[model samples]
Target: MYARKPVIVLLGLAVCGGLGCAQPPACREGQVATPVSAQRHPVAGHHLRAHAHNDYEHERPLFDALDHRFYSVEADIFLNGGKLAVSHRNLPWDSKRSLEELYLEPLQARVDATGSVHGDGVPFTLWIDLKEGGREIVDTLHAVLEKYPMLTRVDGDEVLPGPVTVVLTGDDKAKRDLVTRHSQRRAVRDSNDYSPEDPPADSAWGYYALRWGDYLDASSTGQLDASQRARLACIIENAHAQGRKVRFFDAPDHPDAWRVALEFGVDFLGTDDLRSLDTFLDGAP
Candidate 1:
């Protein structure tokens, strides 16, 4: 017998025996259908803003961090009898480095030559940790800043125009209060180590900085003490609520502190080894 052959049939039925197929709505003339959701492009992740603390004390000066694209740089300034000198510690011989020669002038030249902040398009922050007590330093800084409009300011909620961000650091509570009362200068507070009542009255003058004790230790498995950690968290939250950013210094030279700061989403992380920190921040294994 011959092999049997199968047959296929096609059917186009608008309505079945007991049911009808539903048809999609037709668009009106010259009209398009509405989409459920609009297409969205991806946004870039926030770039890490790194600062070189006490940059002038380094063997190579500001070039290392500037070359590495740090977003902020700090210089500790001590007002001598007549001039603003850069130094981490007050010493006679170290007084040779003036704020103009070691930092301001060179920084001005670099900004002019590159037409960039920290060699980037956006303006970089310059934190001036004042080690002096006289009004002369504050006046000098004000005058110097007049020449650089791009400096950053720390008003409670007031936005001031500038590129370089100047922060006054020291123990002169009287001078700090005076500046806070009169000028647009910013002040630094110890977040991890300071008392709860150390913040300024205006709140804008309350820029908190983290100290060494704020982080967990390698041997401790990144576990900060309960009270200290809680204080740090509260400081970060409170500062953020009041339109302030928290910066940390004197942190451990390990990844634990860095990770903790990152976890808490602190604003600025001050590191001596910018390259290492940058690498770690990039998620290097």
Candidate 2:
């Protein structure tokens, strides 16, 4: 698996207009596109809800997370010379790392090889954080994603679960445009701005990524007091009841935090320490 060659996307002229050049057909308002289910291609493997935060920073990007059997992974990207490059910053050197080469194609290859990323029917998430927002960037991403049908898709308001689910993060406008502009797409949006009072999960906003400090007041000891625990549990329950998977990022990246998140039924536990998290989850009850 490690021996697979990279598939780089050659830069092309980015034309922007109505429907934004995404090749996938858009459904009319109130229409539903075809449904694709991941269960249809089920294979068997231990699928963990671990999320590799800033996964592109790792030595192997998506592969490292998959090696650890992590079901979720995140990558930050920016538009570089008409191509989407994976990086947290707009460093010129980062342009060499195309999103397609680093993450998309490898995931496509995995889906083809194992029927699904893990063959366990548990949806894998590829979180793409857009460093900047614009029609060109959003259009380019949708255009690129149109090539991969392995992604979980949105047909009107319905979700067609596929082997992998691509969630757009970072720029709020770009994420919204992805859903509003296109009626059919291979990706959904990830909202960190969600509140307990917010409306139920729509087809576009699939996950809630909360900042730990924003909701929980934990000390350096990593212990959650009774009130903090209550708050955390309330937030998780509220999000789950609305049909949105929850993830807490910018949290203490240690066993203490991980334990609390697991105990509270937090859906995707964010961590940069992939191997440690894998071992921890394996040893966990």
Candidate 3:
């Protein structure tokens, strides 16, 4: 519930070419700045929609989110010297946090250790936000991802079930390149806001992500107006109709905000508060 971890990324806009957009994310009021308790909460069960935004920033990166049984976790990566290095910024890139070391290898280990689809028996999403890229980098990653057949994959008209799914965000060029090079890959592109009325793109994209602050004009009441709710519902419906999951990233991190998202049938909950969100969803039947 710590307000400092603001929804910095409003996923509504499709990012492409490069990491050029630095527009500050839109914010909604009515969120009280409450400090997240240091006391850790025990895992209750799996939260399929829970996504750990900027998970690498946590003390345990993927492990922390995994402990809570979060279905998805995000990591920011920079392709440096033919190696994908995981870091939030360039100046302090740590070689020890390379994507292979931190995410890929660990994920493969988990998959190998398990007899189920995912190591833990549920689908896990590893969101890789590339800070920079080139064709070779995508090629390298494609090769690396090949070892894990347990990851969901797209083969022509069919999609095979896998334990883990890889999603590429942030840099748009690399995303397009990845899909173009490997049409039948375990990874998919995470793209911007789209409406049902809009003509659908190719099947390369897997999710329609948006920043809620851009669409809804909510008041301090902590509820969306009927018209607002209807608008959101239509977007969700349209995305689902297109076989795409819908995620809104920049919504306020509050119980009311979460309740509204759940009611609107949001497919993913963008959160940094893994424990709090899991606690909230854990109570759901």
Candidate 4:
């Protein structure tokens, strides 16, 4: 179901998508320049918009995504024996990976080593999708997150941005409780809906995560048409205006879908093919 060969990029890996393909600019040779104060960041040219969906499913989990320079990563967790076990299903006994072990610990280590996830102090997002246990699981997560000082914190109306920001998705009531109930929390909630009529973002709601199929149906040929493109643009525009970043879950995990997302200025593009998306975004303007 996935395209093995990379799309979007044509000759010289120049991506035009549906738009007219334009030749890449001529390269100016031998214009190398160096700054007086030299410093190397691990992900110097990282794509700030790349999101690793179901990151834990990968062989290396969080590390794999970081190696590819992904700015955002998602892990699905379920409550098991009062511990947050990372998995997509409710098999607690079968899963031994804890959220702390899989994501939080490694992230904290990276922050400690580089003063940030990528040595750039840019806020990285750790999106936790609650699979079950509702309030119990969320509370457990909050406790675990609090132990890590690298996570972003909120005191009243002030947001202290740290190296990592935890955004909780799924379990609507639990997420709302985390936002409304706690005055000080290490994590925030992700807005599942993106309605133009909805109120602006607050401390609780920092991102808009919509399902791909909820908005538009692909044409008979299973591709987005002009109308879909326009609607997507409007959705992203509305999200941006509301001071909330936008990302679509379960979106088409390929270059064609990625092109439309980039064209519409989607804040984060979720993909299982990390390397392909990284390469595609790298080649994009």
Best-to-worst ranking by lDDT: 2, 4, 3, 1
Q: What's the true lDDT of residue 214 in model 2?
A: 52
TM-score of each: 0.67, 0.82, 0.78, 0.81
Q: Tens digits of per-residue lDDT for model 4 on 112-194?
A: 99999988877799999887646677678778888999999987777899999999898788888877777899988887766
Tens digit per residue, CA lDDT, model 3, 121-217: 6677888887777887788778877877777887755677677888888778998899887877878887865644555544578876676655554
RMSD of 4: 11.1
Order of quality (TM-score):
2, 4, 3, 1
lDDT, candidate 1, residue 284?
25
Tell me the tens digit of each residue's lDDT in model 1 across 1-285.
111122221242112223233211112233332222111112212224566877776776777777656766788876666677778877674444877777667677776777655445566566667765656666776666556544555465565644455555554553365455544553323323343334443433545555543222123324354434544565555456555566767665566666666656667667788777677755622
Estimate the Cα RMSD of every predicted model relative to the unseen true structure.
21.6, 14.8, 8.9, 11.1
Best by lDDT: 2
**Candidate 3 residue spans exceeding 4 A from truth:** 1-46, 116-120, 199-203, 219-222
Tell how far residue 190 is off in model 4, in angstroms.
1.2
Between which residue pairs do clashes occur in model 4?
none
Worst 10 residues of 1 by lDDT: 36-45
Tell me how candidate 4 scores on lDDT. 0.74
Q: What is the C-alpha local distance difference test score of each model?
A: 0.54, 0.75, 0.68, 0.74
